[model samples]
Target: MKTIGVIGGMSWESSTEYYRLLNRHAKARLGGHHNARSLMLTVDFAPIEANQRAGNWTALGDQLADAARQLERGGADLVILATNTMHRVYESIEQAIDVPFLHIADPTGNALRAAGITRVGLLGTRYTMEQTFYTGRLSERYDLETLIPNEAERADVHRIIYDELCHGNVNDASRAVYQRVIDELAARGAQAVILGCTEITLLIKPEDSALPVFDTTALHAQAAVDWAIEPV
Candidate 1:
């Protein structure tokens, strides 16, 4: 199996999920005593978060590129960036490493296409929701149309992500808010909802949404496992 390199800890909460899902996927695919052959280089998110809020993506890109290079040097055959927001700098990381970089969006996009989902709701950091890097890729590559929560709801989603979810705090009140948001999106003609933030799955699950839930963290990790164990 190829070694999966992971750039993680943009928030350790979601990074833990990536690790769990990767091993779970590996075990489910390979049966007894099996797990993913992987290496995770976890960064300190304090400075990363500071840079994100300050709009210093150049520094973030350089930091992530260095992480990717470290993983490559450690014998990782492929790389996965564990956070959806950090993917804003995916191109720099991709360019910095020789290994195949598994973009967090591609797996979700492919699954949405196979399920015939044309229009989808997106929930993530304000940066991810408002910026072109993510939604633009979905439209350009997957022929998918993206919808997001209204401005107020977008603020709620972004706040919950950074303040609560990042700290591993899951409150029922927050979940209810997300449920209402999903219902609102469904009302707006969203065919499915992309849990575009990695930490979103910690708050909302498939059962809680008004539409189908595409959890990017799970899809990304599962895809990494599929790639790692592909026939040589």
Candidate 2:
């Protein structure tokens, strides 16, 4: 078995999910008590969020890359960033670490492609939806086109993420908001939707969507667990 490295605590909300899903998947795969062998580097979220507010990603990237390298030193075979927004500096993090970084976009793109979907709607942090790194990686690297909610709708998306999800509050009203986003995406010709933020699966699921939904967090973590448990 290989050790999976997790670069988490971007909000601790989604990172917690990553930790749980990895273990649950490993247990299901290997046995009742089986769990993944892992190394975790949890960075402070306050400062990262502050950096996001200030648009000072250089320092943030430096900090995240350092964490990645430390995880490698701690014996991680692969690194999972655990949050979609943090992937803005993914290339820098990858260059700093020795282990292969499991890109959230790859499995997602592969899954969407396998399902033969050409266009997908995306919902996440304003940064994840509006920013280039995440969506660009999916488009440029994976050859997938992503449709994001319009400008005014994005504030609502950001609110749902921070005001509710970041605090672990899942409500029916929030689900309704997400459902509306999904519907709007479908109306606009999106064949599917991607939950680009890790914590979003807690709010809206495929069950609530008319279109296919890609839960990037789940896909990314599942791949990590598979790598962690595969025989060396």
Candidate 3:
């Protein structure tokens, strides 16, 4: 198995899921107590969050690039940024590492395409929703149409992610709020909802929404495993 390097702990909450899913999927696929060969570099999210709030993407990119470099030095064959929002710095991270930097959006787009999902609803941090880095890639690469909640709903979604979900606090009220947002997106012609935030899967499940839910976390992890186990 190839070593999968992870840039994680944008919030340890979601990073934990990435680690767990990687191991679980590997074990299931390989059988007989097999597990993933992985390396993880977890950073302090406080400063990263502060920089994000301040719109200091240059500094954020530098921080993430440093982490990716560390993973590469540690013998990682492929790197993954565990958070969706942090993928804004993907280019810098890619440049910092000699290994393959598997983009989170690529697998999500591929999964959506394989499912014949042409339009989908996106829920993530405000930066991810408002910026072109993510949605633009999806449109350009997969011919997918992305729909985001309106300003008001977007604020709520962002709040719930940072304030509650990142802290590992799951509230029924928050789930209800997300459900309403999903309903609005479906009304707007979304065939499925993309859980754009890595922590989002902790709250919303496929059964939670009326439409099919595309989970970027699972898709990204699965893609890594597929790459790791591919015939040489």
All candidates' lDDT scores?
Answer: 0.95, 0.87, 0.94
Task: Supply candidate 3's per-residue lDDT for 151.
Answer: 100
Question: What TM-score against the true fold does each predicted structure earn?
Answer: 0.99, 0.95, 0.98
- lDDT for model 3 comes to 0.94
Off by over 4 Å in 3: none
lDDT of 2 at 217: 89
Candidate 1: segments with Cα more than 4 A from true spot: none
The all-Cα superposition gives candidate 3 an RMSD in Å to the true structure of 0.9
lDDT tens digits by residue: candidate 1, 164-207: 99999999999999999999999999999999999999999898
Which portions of model 2 miss their true places by more than 4 Å? none
Clashes of 3: 0
For model 2, how does the per-residue alpha-carbon lDDT over 40-111 read when each residue is reduced to its tens digit?
888988899889989998998899999998988888888889888888888899899877888888889888
- Report the error of model 3 at residue 72, Å: 0.7
lDDT of 1 at 141: 97
Candidate 2 structure, TM-score to reference: 0.95
